[model samples]
Target: VHHGNGTEEILGSDSRFLFISSHTRGQAFYPGTGAESWKNVLNVPLSLGFSADDFLREWSEAGVPGRIAAFQPQLIILSAGFDAHRDDPALGGRLETEDFLRLTEHMVSLAWGIESCHGRLLSVLEGGYDTSVPTPHRQRGGALQRSVEAHLKGLVSSSRLPSNFTSSVLGKRKKPQCGSIASV
Candidate 1:
């Protein structure tokens, strides 16, 4: 899969933004820059056939979640890329749809943990394969759609989740109430 090479490059020198990238590793993959972590950048490069458990472990054992907590960023920006999905033709990053939901739940809690964030999180649509044709709504594979739905479902159920998960990803301005998908 194509890694966040450009974003990392753009923000590499800027300490104001911490660059944490997780991607499939090795030369066979595209844009192999994030093979190592140094300075303000934390690269959680994964080997081929990385399973759901391995993918989730990046936030823990790989030291990403702690780093984010220590940093306590004011604004949390997420590049929601679902290309690692098993259904995707990308590299062997085998994360299922439910994994995205679980990750999003944790991310929502993590973002709210930063007192300054105040549920202000931005999730940009980054990557998801299967758009073989330019059809209506870019109808990605079920994994991407379900993963996104699962991700949004986590956001919607945020109020019930831990750490005051009133994330702005709920698509609201007048309090973090659940809204329609169009808002997202």
Candidate 2:
């Protein structure tokens, strides 16, 4: 919902840590400090309620990929914020659960290309406010849960054989089984 102003403040100037953030800016967004890129911090601000295609385009065409490749850091950490989900009311980000999986897959592939980041990836759950109360029948969880599962699936997809794609991801994936899911 907000920008990583603290992270940028501490490590933004450090050449060892390259921070690339795609967040909503130039509007009534929170913090209001990441409107421009500086030093190691590459801020790609977009309009409020940005679509999935627009977000992906910023990574694909907006020089993010190029910058990441040029840096070639030893480790890659995804501050996996699910507030961007369409169902999330916090940040007007419109992205499906599948989109998170696809993005994770792409990131994993990108990491694979970097010899320093040879699968040394850490996905830390950051922001997600799917505050909608679920009904009795809809006890199967909300978009945040789905997004986390998709992200986890993406993380594990690389190790799984290509032939077991469909069967491997079947059945219910609980939060505790993967990691702790802090509820808002």
Candidate 3:
């Protein structure tokens, strides 16, 4: 989950939209948003050194999936952000690569469960800037590459539903045009 403040601000009062963000809080981070009081938004703000366990617990306890199910959104847009990874200096979130996988899997399952979603999902890359130095820089390039690879793999792997199910659900959509980007 990304710090989707603008999204929340735009769609907060709209019942059809459920905006959720998991990000670091109280440290005067960039953009400085994602407060808990926003309407129709679920903001899980973590302290420095927050781990995956804390994230999982907050996700489960917040009932994010259940909230989405109740909202029954016809489309799901994911702003996948990886700056929360421990190796990322920008936001020191301490999340492992596998945590991103699990997060993606959960979103995939949630989208699948909604009849209106019809496997209609769009993923926009939002964050994850590795600001570490270049000279002995194992953390910047290597970690960014590995994190991106893992995130893509998780998305691809989770999107592979049974062919029959995919055909039946997605047949109603318009044919894909060249150069158009969409996620299943």
- Considering every candidate listed, which one attains the maximal TM-score? 2
119-168: candidate 1 lDDT, tens digit per residue: 45678878787445435886554666766777787675536444422344
Worst 10 residues of 3 by lDDT: 175-184
Writing each residue's lDDT as its tens digit, candidate 3 over 7-89 gives 78888888768888877776457666776755578887767677878887877887877777887889999887778787776
lDDT of 3 at 42: 85
RMSD of 2: 6.1
TM-score: which is higher, 1 or 3?
1
Between candidates 2 and 3, the TM-score winner? 2
In terms of TM-score, which candidate is stronger, 1 or 2? Answer: 2
Model with the higher lDDT, candidate 1 or 2: 2
Work out how many backbone clashes candidate 1 has: 0
Model 2, stretches more than 4 Å misplaced?
131-135, 159-184
lDDT of 2 by residue, 74-137 (tens): 8998888888888887756888888898888888777766766665679899877874446887
lDDT of each: 0.72, 0.74, 0.70
Query: Candidate 1 — what's its lDDT?
Result: 0.72
| Model 1 residue 64 CA deviation in Å | 1.2
Residue 76: error of model 2 in Å?
0.6
Model 3: residue 106 alpha-carbon error in angstroms: 1.6
Instruction: Show the lowest summed lDDT stretch of 10 residues, model 1.
Output: 164-173
Ranking by lDDT: 2, 1, 3
Candidate 3 wrong stretches, greater than 4 Å: 131-140, 158-184
